[model samples]
Target: MTVSKKRTISDESRVFQEKWSHNYFFIQVKEKAICLICQESIAVMKEYNLKRHYSTKHAAKYDMIEEKLRIDKLALLMKNIQGLYLSLKTGHKDSEASIKASYIIAQKIVAKSKPFTDGEFIKECMEVSFEILCPAQKQIFSKLSLSGVTIARRIEELGTNIESTLKERISKFIFYSLALDESTDLSDTIQLAIFVRGVDSNFNITEELAALFPMKGTTKSCNIFNALKSTFNRFDIKLNNLSGVITDRAPSMIGKNEGLIALIKKEMGTCGALQLIQYHCIIHQENLCGKSVGFQTIMKDVVKIVNFVRSRALNHREFKNFRSEIDAEQGDLIYFTDVR
Candidate 1:
């Protein structure tokens, strides 16, 4: 027995015919057959469906019109629909451009470490620039949303995307190092910053801030080690890949018996024969040395000597000439006291 297959909607040729527009006063607007009288759309493109809709709903009002009048009406409706479709198409493109611009502006603001409210200032600048260069684009520019809240949302979305990409790359790390620092915020809350520098099998190195953990309670060596272990677990990477640790070298970090580095070494030793390098931050070490040695006292004497030489016009000119003769850097002693 032969079973016949039913024809699917895809099998039918449903293109709108030209005669239907003139006879039924129907025209295709964005693929749907629309009646000129009521501006109602017929979902099915078949002549039968279009005819039935016109006869049932609008035939009484428009049936009395002459042939010339019907043709005129059809032409006017087609013109109006074309204009509306054109405007809608332009609006769609402008909307997409506005969204892209918003993201770009948001990213720039964040990269510059500016506040979210700066987006409003940026929008104002954009508006002024547009007005000066091309006033016709004011309407399109207005579609962009650069409010403070919108900027914040865009920045958060960007951060999430970057984090997602980093997670994907983390799984491929052949070796990695960590850098840690702790500081107190404006609210007096301690923030432990963890940064990762990882190398993949292809030897591509990626370095980024992994996380910032808040420590409202104790910030002991054990606390730091536990937090680090939690971070490693979250990333789902092997402990064997931890090749190095860089730290600010506080007593809690470098203590011989119970430091964070000592704890990590013990953990890695049990896993296997591993070589983990412990590094102290050079800049931090320098800062500590300067503070301990009273760098301010030394700088005070130097500043006094500079003032003695440059305070008088004669001494300043002689010093300048002497420096030029020696090919020294071009600068007078101008110290910014705020810098440490």
Candidate 2:
């Protein structure tokens, strides 16, 4: 029998040069190449085995490293883009403007009596109205504090702004007349309403409701005067600018000795103004005159009949329906009050 000889490759004849061979560490021992990365031996000592090892084992690591670098670079680019957008939109590189913008938006919301937590409002603005807002504006809204307390503070700020504006405008007026009236609301709380009519430097009329002072305790003439004085002092309203005072025929309002009008006149006299014209409300005078007419008996009968028709629920509904069916111009009788 003939014996077979084993084939062995020599290092001198082995082809180690390959494109992938440079990427891996190799060791040659006994004419066999060993791949350091995979810790495996190459028996035949050819480029194919090394290339196959690299493609199969270490190719995923290369791909992963490349993907990670790409993702990191992309993330950095996006960050720079966001920073550029913010710089372009807000006109500032800071978040301070967001606070002022939020307050302004809150002021409008409060002025319009909108619900403070209406997230749908912002959503609608983002989607429809303010969809063209720049990235900075979007970022501002995202970082804003729009809680209920924040809204409430904004409302107070709005009121302060309004008061400041009113004070400025009122200061431009040379003379102003105060129309004051006291009345009780449905809750039986006594309220003193004061309005001012003034002419500006341009001779334009400016009429404003000055105050709605609540009278908690005794509403005597002294208390009324004190309240008016406090309001005037708070607003820096000058007594020298007082031109006229008008009020209803209430004793506490117009009494010569201790009335609010008399006290104001006394203060004006001390300030050296000759006279502050006083006038009773024309409506009150007309109402007083109407009461003196000789139609009291007829008024009583009319009131009784009107009450019979309007006081009962069924009668009131039937009367209303009849009036509608007949196309009556005056559907219900006019309500009258006994002032006396």
Candidate 3:
């Protein structure tokens, strides 16, 4: 047999042959090559695996551009957050300080981030800004923490002390007129205020607040008498020097047999008793007679129109513009006054 010259295998051919043989052996042995990206692999190369590998290991050049874009977007978001935070802090500085500080810190966080672009990010910043700007809710919590009964008792004690001090000073006046009135607050709490009218050294009517008390009931004459007597005793006021009592013509005050006037007269034996005088309050009489009917009606009508206009979006804008114009012309508008 002619010995054929041994054919030399090229380096690439040899390497290919070795790789093919290794792959064949691995398949026969049921072994697999692990993908670096996903950590699992099939016998054949997967497109997703290949892409992942390229992205993780060979994408350094493209990553620089992506990172720069991300940083710029983040910076923009941060700037917006900073602006919102500053606005909120400035708005609430008068109402709450601690809340403003927290908002400022949050704003700094957003500002420090690289620029970014995402509607969600902007929306989140806006939400946080609104939360910071909301009125302080902690005030209600603080008020709720106070003891209601204790607060009421303290107020009563203060009123009593004030009444006592006023009485002591008033004892110097030889003659004084006691004016009693009942009024109701917004909460409908009945309050009785006493006023003292006497001539001072300068011969001027020196009117002063003498006492104030919460009335038990509107129609209870006995309660009123007892309250008045207790107040007098508390202030060490002698019934002998009590000059005259001026009050409205209310049934509880001036009723014939069971009223405060009758009780005081019985106690002082009629001669040393308090002189009862009926005086109608001018303000109360005016209110009852509807004296400012036209003025009040006009004011109410104007307010209603203004409110109606403000309720609509377009009208509100128009109203604001009109208000600015009116303010500009206000200096030229002369207010007429009657000097009679």
Candidate 4:
């Protein structure tokens, strides 16, 4: 009973057996092999070749997707660094961490471009790289604080420019008037106020504050004149353009022979310097008239009688009662006036 001598397998069957037994990659389907894991027949190709195809093509697609993501992250980092550079250029105060973060982002951008071996070259590139990202309206100084010296220097510069502009316009005017006044404040500091009036090219009267100076001595005509001359020279205003002067009739301002008006006329000319019209202050004149001898004498007896009653506390009550009785009969108090 030779049982067909254990049907010896051929070379083809041996080769097939060997190939089937060898390790073969498989395609992932739902995290497992599609045919074997799901128990389905892969009619087109063997499991090994299918797995090789899926790995080479599908796995490569994943690598490309990851590379794209990395590139996008680098681009975002560069954009953030540019924003921080702009903020610094505009003098915006940033935290140390913020600066370091921006620097790191910039370093990453630089490093990824090429492998920088030289330290100096790398530093130079970093310095120049962020400069172009600076904002257009960059501030040289921060607005946080300013020293007194800085403020004063700026003011001096502005004043010099203004003075230069004014000098050019001053020569264009032919005639000008000067008005002077003195005032004392609550601090008892005397201020000399000066104003200049002139007609512009349009022939309209223009008044401007010429100068405000501290009075060193008494407001004398000579002192004021000297100050005016000095101020005019400082501002480059020509004295030959002086045509008129106006001042109040105070003794120092309008003394008969020695006053501001007299001094100006003496220095300049009578044609260019003339006294202003006298319109006496009505309130001051009224006060003086009330204290005149005629009005004082008329009120003297009434004042004495009132003071006699006011001096005694008991007589004051009786005086008030008497006055009330007289007022009651008079219907209302009447004030008499003299037409003259």
Best-matching candidate per TM-score: 1
| Best-to-worst ranking by TM-score | 1, 2, 4, 3
Sorted on lDDT, highest at the top, how do the candidates line up?
Answer: 1, 2, 4, 3
Specify the poorest-scoring 10-residue window by lDDT in model 1.
331-340
Per residue, candidate 1 scores C-alpha lDDT tens digits across 17-132 of: 99998878888877888887667888878989988988888788878876889788878878887788799999888899999999999999999999999999888888899999
How do the predictions measure up, each by TM-score? 0.76, 0.52, 0.36, 0.40
lDDT (C-alpha) at residue 33 in model 1: 86
lDDT of 2 by residue, 46-73 (tens): 7777767768887676545445574564
In lDDT terms, how accurate is model 4? 0.56
Q: What is the model-wide C-alpha lDDT for candidate 1? A: 0.87
Q: For candidate 3, write residues 1-340 as lDDT tens digits.
A: 8987775434223211223212221111124333322233444333344446546663564345445574564445445655665877765663465433333433443356522223235434545665677635433222221133333443455556666667666666556666777888787888888777764355555577766778756647787777777766766656665667777767888888987777776776755745544455666677766875756666677767766775678877776677688786532212233359
| Stretches of model 1 off by over 4 angstroms after superposition | 10-15, 27-43, 64-69, 104-149, 270-273, 291-340
Off by over 4 Å in 3: 1-164, 185-188, 199-206, 265-275, 291-340
Q: Which residue pairs show collisions in model 1?
A: none
Best by lDDT: 1
lDDT of 1 at 90: 90
Q: Count clashing pairs, candidate 4.
A: 0
